[model samples]
Target: MKGGATVPIGLTPEQGQLQEAVGRFAARHAAVDQTRDSFEALAEGALPKWWNDLVSHGFHAVHLPDGVGGQGGSLLDAACVIESASAALLPGPLLPTVIAGAIVLSVDDMAAAKLLSELAAGATATVVLPESGDLSATATDGGWRVTGASGDVLGVRSAAVILAAARRDDGETLWFVLDPEVASASVEQRDGTDLTIDVGMLRLADHVVPEALVLNGIDDDAAWDITVALSACASAGTLQWAVDAVTEHLRTREQFGKPIGTFQALQHEAAMLLVNSELAAAAAWDAVRAVAEAPEQRQLAAAGAAIMAVAPAPELLLDALTMFGAIGFTWEHDVHLYWRRATSLAASMGPITGWSRRLGELSKTHVRDMTVKIGEAEADFRAGIAAVLDEALGLVNDKPSPLGDYDHLASGPQRTLIADAGLMAPHWPPPWGLGATPLQQLIIDDEFAKRPELVRPSLNIAEWVLPSIISSGSEVVQQQLIPPTQRGELLWCQLFSEPGAGSDLAALSTRAVKVDGGWRINGHKIWTSSAQYADYGALLARTDPDAPKHKGIGYFIIDMRADGVEIQPIKTADRDPHFNEVFLADVFVPDEMLLGGPTDGWSLAIATMAQERVAIGAYVNIDRAIALRRLAAQRGPDQDAVVRALGELDAYTNAIKALGVRETIRLLDGQSAGPASSIAKVATSIMLRRTFKATLELAGPLAMVERSEPAIVAPYLRLPAELIGGGTRQIQLNIIAQMIMGLPRK
Candidate 1:
């Protein structure tokens, strides 16, 4: 069976090209059948026939310095090659060799030069971190005597050299480069789970290592960090292969009179698999980037990758096999090889719980910066925007309320300053906005973020609705609504969801009969947020009942205060009157108020909903994480469980933010948000739920009472709204499965 195309995982155009090139090379030289055929040779400590082919391309030296006989590329460059190679299940010691190379390069450059040049010339090496072995080093004349036994070490059998860590008598760790051919050294091959690589135990009996071979600049912690980073990249690659294989199977394999991909249950599972794969790739990408650009953040990034990608691979691949059914269980299928590799890799990475605790400890002082870097050309634009923001800041009386609150509109003068300057919606067209590119939009956001005191006026629902008016509305509609909405003078609500139609907006039964010079609408809209205060609503009503459900709807701008318009507040479980039910009885909307053609409402609604999903996904709320950290701080530092929970939450939070950054980059490159928006919506909802639940658990008895603390109890109560609103989580998953995975629609 042919495989589905691998999902794109590059962060830049150059990296994308490299990924493609390496993928093609792997397909041509190290395909799955070849990898399978080499199992016997790999078990016998024999290197792959294509090992030289790979080294000739400088794959092992991509991350090393040019002076060290490397390709002078960043760690991310090496990661692209590793991920692509792992996707093909290439049989060899490339991963361990790179890990050993990175650790050696970071410490002893002179020693690394020789080792790296050898590696670039097709010599393989393996690293044995302290966690993977028990060894001791004693200082002696002109050398150190090492004696101990290493646990199962990957690629040790075929390695020309072994970079192993041994503890001194004082409990300090020392790293040394030991030649495998040393007189007293021996390698014992072990039957490991992964078939594409050799694993063995190394025994050292008073083996003398020369002083020059002893690496002084590295320790156990640093070595493991390097190991986790590279391992994560390889694991992410394996996950991508599994995803592509399963996606192909689902697309072609049929049961129950149709393709299994069309089933909603399978589609949801497939969508989640894709989401997790994206998260894994993102964590790996972050780890490599941190190694290249921010040394201080390497541990934190690695811990995140460990929790989000490396440690979870085994189970994720197992889940993929279940999706493949009985055929996947057979030994002949290639899926089992990936599962075995994932299991072995996860085991090699050690326990995820420890990584989670480490992450929490690191996060107390260091945070992974999520700021988008704009080019130097935006420096002047940023300065000018800073001036305007400063002026607006001077006009505010105290700090303004949050942006999305219905009753917390910015002051009239402040709104005028911001809207007139086109800072309210910088991505909008000229006059109303600067017609700013995505980069400029990021810069504007950065400027506003600097001055937390100057709150931009909230458009609320208008933020989602006005875009439709701008794109599909008549000139009169645009002029009448856009400016005021931008200035916070006109608030809007959505009249699309009704009692009969919530997720299925096209099935709306509201009737809009054409009358003299206008149309009369009669409908009931439920769960309409801010309808009580909205000046107008973006309404959908069926103008032709006999036509198809999606074809006869009309998009209209309904006046909330018109005759026969009634808004009844619906008290939520949180006891807040934030949602309302709007009743329209013969509410007349003039012909000019119609947004597009009579039957064009479905497309317009879809566009509006897409914007809504993107808007929702782009907003990352880490308030729960912040609250949990604060609560944990008050509870003292002895709570290891709380720390681990915080770390896990931070990992999810980072992944979500990375998704947002990826979406922004896509937009910057003039690409659509695509199914990633839906994936984001699903991910955000799950993260929020987990975060709030964790916070409440941390709060203990204080969270039991409704009046104990609004922060603790209110968010937990309002969690259901997040699930149901903006298309339910299940609905979003269905969309993702169909759109991104090419699963047949239910």
Candidate 2:
């Protein structure tokens, strides 16, 4: 976990610092062997040697309020420490202690002040809720007598305070704190799967407790949400460790004359590990943030995290172990410990099926709120942007054409209004755009999203091309093309992918010989979307044939209507003529049309492709998932498979959204965007393909019909293009493996 591209769990600077501090502390104080040594101590019902060191550093009370003798940080802050500590395999009751503290804090502030103070002062605790056992409470004069056999609870052996839940005879659940030293209460250490912490069972035989210790404000759901959130954080940390360990192993370990990571199969597998780790981290971050800042969103976030991160964790760890080959299976290696821990954590959550059902049921009524935070300084900017969108909405409403109509010529004025106001491409430079920062871009998106009817016209390929054009095009070219393109008058198509050069565009043989005042383009491009409707095309051709493949190309703007330019529609599986084969025979492009230097085409093309990937990756359509949810709801909950499928789809969809939010925050924080875009591209493609396939399966026999709900069948058939369009899934995986994981290329 020290080096290599570990997908980050903490997003902000402070959180990152906290993660680093905890990581450094763990490396120095709680080494791997130290954790291994703790196995015996833990089994003997004794605390790890590093337990006092950890407590002295204030790790246990990071999330408690300052008034409670704590540092007054959010749960996310605590999550950062937990993730880092778990990554180091720190052996103690850190997780359960944090969970117990958070649950108490969430219920009663006054009680939390005392309990949290004790925790902050180095006392340990554990929680035993109804999910783990059937405990019953009987009312007494001044206290309640509890009786039950509790399930195996982590940290119970060393815990001074026990947070237990019991069902009263009146069908009401009572939550109370019990002193483990009580005479009638018995604590027995149990051998468990994970060796990093002591696990024990608590049995109470009419053990009396003070009413003062009772937490009447908390219930089963609230406690469960808190547990899931904190557990998810620890899960993220362990998954991260596996990712880093496997990645480093793959990078250095060689087979068949190269690093094993160089093999495409291994690379793809490693890339998937990164993807899942990222999704897990995002889910964990979102869940903890919801617990800290958004009380209303707690249950949904927790359920989402449980399915997205916690449930798949054990399997994800197993996948990592498989990637490590026989070495991972050895007792000497650390992978098995993570697998056991993940398995125990998942079990502690009481089955993922229940979580999936809860998520599916929640999906029917609630959507996760993904709004970005707007700061005070940006209030004026947001207001101005909102006012512009309001005007655009009015203009859109006044239009004669009905909404959703197929009118290529409709809403021209509305598009111009938005584009002229710089709302269309606010991230672009001024005049054409506001040269907006990432925050401003997000704000603009927020304002526009508020008024969905005032749709800013899709720029088609121009959305991918215009950035390069603005960055490298001549001033005259920019003046002539950018304004009109922004207004949606100039639809553009990419002319890069040749029959033989689909993913490897540098291998393209399209030729463009320099003529006196221009370049004569003669080549062919296939799978060109919207070529027939495009007013212009961005062409990549070899300007110098003798030079290297990537070194001799030129990027030129071509007039799709120019002489010798031909567009032939290619009917795809969906039977739509959206794709076309464009052939150019001596199509003349003037000197100004050539973007950048002649040899700069490859770099420019790469930049465009990067932007393309980002755009495609960011555009996750959960509509299919919603449609499936509606269909599943109609079929009722009896369809467990449908419910599970819906839950899985919703989980990945939110994971993708979480990635988008993480990326936006990363950019806003002035950090490099990293490989998130590439990761998103791969994850989104897989999620979408699975979602459509699941829809078809859930639809039963009706999906086989020719006209079976065009909504479902159309996307199913059209998904292949998505896989191949921006960049093939394989290509994206290669990018992620190499760039993010630091794996060597073949």
Candidate 3:
């Protein structure tokens, strides 16, 4: 993927232009050789000329208030600038200086205000985070005495002032802006993994600091949040570069007479790296927005960024290293350079355990009722839709139940009411649907969400099957069934896989014979969900036995109640009979029931499967994610192990949600689903397994005794089905390799 290949995660057009400009500057000034030279220069207490250029550009003042003599931009702007710099491997004091400026500008005191101006004017700054060992400050006659030591302080060598947190005698943490040149300190340069940046140890003796240098009311938590958010942004940019670099390698590098990217294994690895990169991007972007727009949720967002990006950055980079093969091991390749920076950034944020525990504690209480702003036009559209839905709900309630006490939503006046209001399938075209755009579709869901009591009718199989039918099914079939299906007048099932065919659907042995007025079908379909209750099925059978396997297949709409159709319930691990085996013995189907043509079933199946992937992959199971958090909160205090797992589950769940949001945006932009779409099912499968395992672990002895939480334990028994259903994880990977990555088929 290129720079603009996918939309820059959370940037506006203006910010994107800024990013491009910074990128061009970095390209000219921060080449690999230049980075090495700057590192050496910083070690000798000399500033590189490019550092002044950056300051002149106002990159260091992006997060500061204009009233304090700095640019009045949001934290998001600072994030973008640092991200661009990090991507080019620019060695600088930008991150720390920007963070320090934020703190100084936050206070209204004259001294703090004056410091903010100096910072914005390009005075270099370094930070010693709260996670560093206790640095104490005690009040003296007219000043304060500070004493402590911090290791691995980035930009310390070139920093004019150091921003640090120290505990006072009253047990309150105070933010102090100390001039390294003014204090008695020893700054020794140290060698580290990332060679492009300057880092060193700072030893501060018991020295007196003037009262003007100390800023009151700066909470330790607030400072930590700022540092984590900024570091995450920088790390995210580096990881993205790794992703693109590795991708470029796979595209051009060849092995054994073909491009190595043609291999399925490599494609799957690249796909996962892409997933991690997106997750990091979303996390960093969301964190900065939280700090700027929703201060109340800032802690939660910062912790989420750590859990999602900071902790995983190093590992993702290592994976990228693996993709680069032996050549990446050498220093010349720049892979090791990124790996070092990733690890260094992770270390700077402190231990992952502490972050996870904080995240767990926060997740236990946070409701996560997040809503992204989609502009005033979208807002008005949502309001109108909400009013319409409110009226529809009142009308439905006034009428008697057309379900006739059946208590099911598959059919009845309730379904009819929703269908009449064009709410049944808003994504579909008019009459049957409202032809809603992606954003409009979201707005519709938002309205429906407000009415939790009103059940949205669904035809489980028709969710994707009906869409496929409308796209390729004959006009008669669409006209006859689509409206009824939308109205909840008919239920549908799918019969595309046989026991012997499973992932290899084209090898199905089911046979369809053409007759004078219809086709005679004889086939056996297994693992069909809701088959016994289905009124119809989107069936796939062989029409031309002599042709190739895929070319001979045809798709049709078969009446489940037709003569010679046998449906036998198959008990699953949970002992529920939702799945069934259908055996068709010369089942007769009218020619009108055929979808597309006799030789188009394979293509139709592909389209339907893609839709299925999108539907399943984009569905965020917020309830499940929240339930785990609740369990962690309710568990015994001694259950630290389970709490850690709970935190991990929370992070993974949020990651899935973030990935879904990206996919939705991609679709809204009219970009077709790519490799990310293919791997979503795979990623979700892994997430489910981890979630269930954590739930069971949290349950402990309770799971072994009698019946446990049905929602938690039962899913374990059905986990294998999820991995195998829709398509096996391996099959999905193969699709990603061949279709999305352009790999040659085996």
Candidate 4:
């Protein structure tokens, strides 16, 4: 397009073309719904014959270098082709074949070329061992014998050859190639939830390989990389399939005469899925590319993926299935195929949760590794913030304004300043903070809000538009848009949440059609905050109503100054004109203004919203709780009921807080949120309600004491407002009970 200097991640043109060709070839022979069914029916150890076509498709050798008789494709090619294969739920020996081939190449084994060539030519192969449960190869003799068996070998039943890792007498583990035709081999059958891998035990005895065949010893980094890479790709593939399927269903399927996806409960679910999807993708890429990154970074990335996969991905899929109702359970439905494969892959690699524990183990190694490197940006920032926070905190007695008591708004400006100082930039990319030390991110985050005059991020303009643009918009768009917006420069508004579909966003009927060189957007967006003062608006409009629900949506950055736009400010419970009723009679947005592609808007919106709701759950409720606690302290010793209530409140709050932390850790560890956050959000709201009730009772009839200044009552009045702000309390419970607990819906 213009001056072509852009670096496209790890993808090369030759690799791209080769991947496309391979995809076409594989698709021709790929397992269809019927083929998968047939494969499932075949008992014993037999794999479907179509698997041979995958070998012929050059899939197994896709990641191998040219010297190994491979197309010498790039890793991106491997990911792309494998993801496509996974989406179709293609069944065969590809995972094991490729993984084994990579293992062989990893150890610098020359025998890999011949075996990989055979695999590329259609002979399925499997990697039998990687030093046991910890994946560190162990003990040997007569060269290296395939002794202690590997239980997770997916293609063991079909492989004519297997590569097993065993340790030499020197206590070094090495890869040993086993020609099944030569060795005594047997595959143990096991049934598991995730059906993607037909897992079996590869039993081998007396199979021997000399020094030439013993790739690299146990300490070889390449062998571990290859194994981790394969497992990661499969996991990533499973996550993608689950997310895509759920998105499709939630968008099209109907409930209460509207698209079910428009529901807050569903959108939040989808948001969680999107976060897991992105983080998981990042982790997989991180692991695949870790061979090139610094040691600790690689380990950290893998840890991230394992954390996400264990909890959110599985929970999301199961939630999606339950959302789909009865049809999802049937064998004929393709949905179960993804569920089966996702869980199976997890079990195969000891699941994402186990990887996290592995990550925890790996974490120990990284502490020392960090000592070997220099990290100035992260170091300076942490030092700078901590020193400033501790020193300045003593001076922040209280605000002169009434906000000192009603901290919800009082905290907003300080939060904005902290963000301006780049503390909020931790989760953001390098342009923002220390791209390293994600662990320290949490610590600094608490510091940002807890510092005296405890301010939090502003609600309007900056929060809504800047992040949304950076994530999905082009470099050109971000350059023109983000800097100014981020500097508190340009004010923006969100034109979503119509009266017709407050929670059911995808059900919106606003239309945006391509016109001239750009788009003519004509839509009515209700419940829009800051729309009246907006310089720009983040608009979600229906691009193709004819297309499926989610498929038709488009995300656009619209100029609020455009002639046709009209905004009507709406007053809320606070008796202030905050949210706007925006009418886009006919607004135009060019190609440059669109975020990502047309359809990806749904995905972006979901991502943006998820971070938002979670942040609100984390940040917003704190002040309200603290205000209640402080007010309770001010009310002397006479209120027994309030005291007893506060006691139970402390106990419940502690339990809920602990649950929140663990659930967060689980999601972080690649496990599911499993209704934990949903429960937290609802409980927070409920507790706040209880706390407010106690405050009113303890006001000892002065609870009705009205002050001239309305701000005086804000501390007490704000709880009800927050309960309704992000998403309703009722929806959160429905999600917790239905998705997390597997309870029947009301």
Model 2 CA lDDT for position 21: 90
Can you write out model 2's per-residue Cα lDDT over 1-746, one digit (the tens) per residue? 22556556788899898899999998998888777866888875687776788877888889888877787888888889888988888777889999998888867655556787888888899999874777888999998988988988888988989889888889888888888888889998888788888888999999886777888688578788889988988888889998888888988898888889889898899889888888988888888777754554777788888988898999999999999999889999999998988888888898788988777777777778877776665899999998887877666423322213543234477777888888667888887789999988988877777776665565656889999888998888888998888776677889999998788888999999988999898988999988887888999999999999989999999999999999999998878786899999999999999999998999999999988998888668536675587677775544777877787788788888888888888899999866678888998998888898888887776666656543667567777877887998989888888877888887
Question: Candidates' TM-scores?
Answer: 0.95, 0.96, 0.90, 0.52
What does candidate 1's lDDT look like per residue over 1-746, in tens digits?
A: 12443345566778878888787878889888888878888987898887787888888878888876788988878888888878878788999998888887777556656777777667899998985678898989998888999989999999998888888877888778888987899999899899999999999999898878877888577678778888988999889988898888888899988888898888888778888888887787777666744655778888888988888888889889999999889999998999998889988987789999898888777888767777675788889899998998767433343334333375477777888898877888977789999999888888888887676566667778888888887887788888878777777888889998778998999999999998999989999888887889999999999999989999999999999899999999999876899999999999998888888899989988887887777656445676667665665554777788889988877877776777688788887554567777888888888888888777777787876543678677877776777888899888777777778875
Whole-model lDDT, candidate 1? 0.82
Better of 1 and 4 by TM-score: 1
lDDT of 3 by residue, 1-746 (tens): 23222234444666777778788888887787777656666555566678788878787887777876577888788888878777777776777777777655557787787788788888998887764766788989988887877768777877888887777788877677777776477777877556666788777789787888778766577778888888888888888788778777887888998888878788888767766776777777767766654454777677778888888989898898988898988867888888888898888888888777777776776734356445555777787778777766664433222323332244556667677777778888876788989889878877777798666665556887988777876777888888887776777788988989887989999999999899999989998877877789999999999999989999999999999999999988877775789999999999888887899999999988887886667544635554465566564764576667766766666666666665666677676654556656777777777777777766766567445544556656766666676887778767655555454454
Give the lDDT of residue 40 in candidate 3. 65
lDDT for position 506 in model 3: 91
- Compared with the true structure, model 4 gives a TM-score of 0.52
**Which runs in model 1 stand beyond 4 Å of their true positions?**
1-6, 293-296, 397-409, 635-638, 670-674
Q: How high is the lDDT of residue 538 in model 2?
A: 91
Better candidate number, 1 or 4, judged by lDDT: 1
Among residues 3 or more apart in sequence or in different chains, the pairs in candidate 1 whose N, CA or C atoms overlap within 3 Å are none
Q: For model 2, what is the alpha-carbon lDDT of residue 174?
A: 81
C-alpha positional error of residue 433 in candidate 4 after TM-score superposition, expressed in Å: 20
lDDT (Cα, tens digit) per residue for candidate 4, span 639-734: 334434444344234334434444444444454334445545665676677666665665555555544222234556545546765668766644
User: Candidate 3: which pairs clash?
Assistant: none
As for TM-score, the candidate ahead, 2 or 4, is 2
> Candidate 2: where are CA atoms >4 Å away?
1-3, 293-296, 397-410, 635-638
RMSD, every candidate, angstroms:
2.5, 2.2, 3.4, 14.5
Give the lDDT of residue 356 in candidate 3: 72
* Predicted structure with the largest lDDT when compared to the true one: 2
Candidate that scores best on TM-score: 2
